[model samples]
Target: MSGYLMSPRQFSALKTGLFLLCLVPLANLVYGLLSDTLGANPIEALTRGLGDWTLRFLLITLAVTPLRRLSGLNWLLKLRRMLGLFTFFYALLHFASYVWLDQFFDWAAIWKDIVKRPFITVGFASLLLLTPLAATSTNAMIKRLGGRRWQLLHRAVYAIGLFAVLHYWWMVKKDITQPAIYAVLLTLLLGLRVYWMLRRAGAR
Candidate 1:
């Protein structure tokens, strides 16, 4: 942990604040559900709400390395594990809402949706990619897999992000503006990594 960012107390407080902020959306969902205030389409609202947070957390997790690189706040990396887990958490809720509320756990219909629907296929693939990352995000798993192999497995996160954006884009048939914005943001993030990679290769 770099001593440059803030005192230990302040750092802990920052994490606490971020943790509560992340929970706000889930809390709002619960409140709306209990009050019957999620408009006429509660299932759609719940699913979309969960997807929004999943994307937000994914982007935030991706931002951590760049943030630490630019700002030199090395401790920022510590937050990535929590943020990554939250990404998977919301993703699980998104899939669960679809299966339980939308399809009523009808395996046939769900399988048809996964196979037939482009958006669902992309979303499901992203979830599958994320599962191993979330499951192995422990010190034990790290030691077992070894750092090099663990990093190779986790690199699928970039592909997950791409699949997620594609899933959203394919889902929204009418308005592409929102999806476009996320795509552009993700492209910029990818571009930054590519730029640094080429620079490093050139240096070598």
Candidate 2:
């Protein structure tokens, strides 16, 4: 089916709805942590769970473009920014939890851990890369950067995705099924990007 563009009002409504939808996971995590429902090593569980959702949203946001093109629903573009920002939001929480709860706000120790641990290094890199994208995600910045340049700059999201997947894969000790799934999904997303790029080149 062809996808119609949503009206501004419709888009606003969807944004509000999605904002509430995103809160569910955070709420559950908080409830689980406060009530002591998270089994053995609550902090670790919370960290992993939040990180997982961050990556999940990142992938989901990336998928939106391909899905829109394939399904002929252009309105999907309106949701990508919100999803991407939510991904960053969760990532921030995940990193904060590690810094505050896990490391007791020890900057030196955190830096040491990042240098020493490959997973932390990858995760930290992913966050660092996302920082600028988040910061520049505004209408004025888009205008200032120009469409082509802004798009090129935002391509760092792909690197963020790779780093996120690597971080997860490296963190797992034995049961690698979850990380493997994310890896496969990320591969598909990247593959779609390549295909779309080639398709555009052919059209040009």
Candidate 3:
């Protein structure tokens, strides 16, 4: 583990690199729109592209702990906050696209869709749940809330992830292949948590 661990300079560089790499997806989306490269349904493409990245980031954030534990790379914990924030960032963009592009700021229709459509409802709820996670992501907030309470609050992420997966699943009613892949990945991530919890309890 020591051999594999990164130096301060190396870690800083890696974090910067990861941060920039994360923005590439949004950059590509912007390029697609500006260059008129996105197909006929550009709005749909943009919205789905943002939503897809949100899910990807969410899964990546959740995997950090397990990866850190397995690989004995404790510095991975430092990256978790950035990854989680990016998850919320993408999710915000996704929700914003749905409200602005898809609904055209038609609050009435948006409200109705949230109420009537299960997928929209789930997606909306996921965003709602993510709001506080993003808000309290700061070190100041962590100190103010206390470590235990902060952990409890952020635990809502598990539900958010499940709802996110369900939202994607229900949205693509016919072709569920992508959603299923996310579901399986999420299941494994969560399964690892459960296994660790049970192992700790047994040790106790």
Candidate 4:
């Protein structure tokens, strides 16, 4: 795909818009908490809300690659790291809610929950996997790791995405609607990636 540059001013405006847009969820959550409007099960609601946004942001982050390739919007790449970090940020909140509210800092209980509950097991493992990705997201780390190695490490996102969807799918036993939607989105993203890989191999 041919690349066209966006002007610095235009790019700045877009970034600003995305920054605010990303904050909208957190703002809404805070408002809901303060107003006691997050339904009767507030902690569960907050945990679910954060988890939902984490999945959404992960899908959005993964979309940037296909979006840029298809649309020739190279500037979209700039937002990938930010979107990814937001995924981790929300994931942290989801985990924290579980730890503080549900587990109450009970290490033994938490460990038992992680080991005993398959959903929690995968969810906790996914969060642990995400930690290094989030830590190594800096430009400095990329430079230090070298392009090839950094790319290799970041490929974990695909696995993380799958694990995240599985976590959600397992958590929701009855109403599978939300998890089903996320599964479709993830399938599309993974499919696009596979298509591009095959295309590249064909070209070679």
Give the least accurate 10-residue stretch of model 2, judged by summed lDDT.
1-10
State which candidate, 1 or 3, has the greater TM-score: 3
Candidate 2 Cα misplacement greater than 4 A, ranges: 5-7
lDDT of each: 0.92, 0.92, 0.94, 0.92
Residue 190 displacement (Å), model 2: 0.9
Sort all candidates by TM-score, best to worst.
3, 4, 1, 2
The digit string of per-residue lDDT tens for model 1 on 42-129 reads 9889989889888888988999988889988788888899899999999999999999988999999999999999999999999999
What's each prediction's clash count? 0, 0, 0, 0
The numbered model that scores best in TM-score is 3
Off by over 4 Å in 4: 1-5
Q: Output the lDDT of residue 121, model 3.
A: 97
lDDT computed for candidate 4? 0.92
User: Deviation in angstroms for 48 in model 3?
Assistant: 0.3
Q: Candidate 3: what lDDT?
A: 0.94
Model 3, C-alpha of 30: deviation from truth (Å): 0.7
Candidate 3 local lDDT, 1-204, one digit each (tens): 352566789999999999999999999999998898999999999999999999999999999999988988888888899999999899999988988998899999999999999999999999999999999999999999999999999999999999999999999959999999999999999999999999999999
Measured over all alpha carbons after superposition, the RMSD of each candidate to the real structure, in angstroms, is 1.3, 1.8, 1.3, 1.4
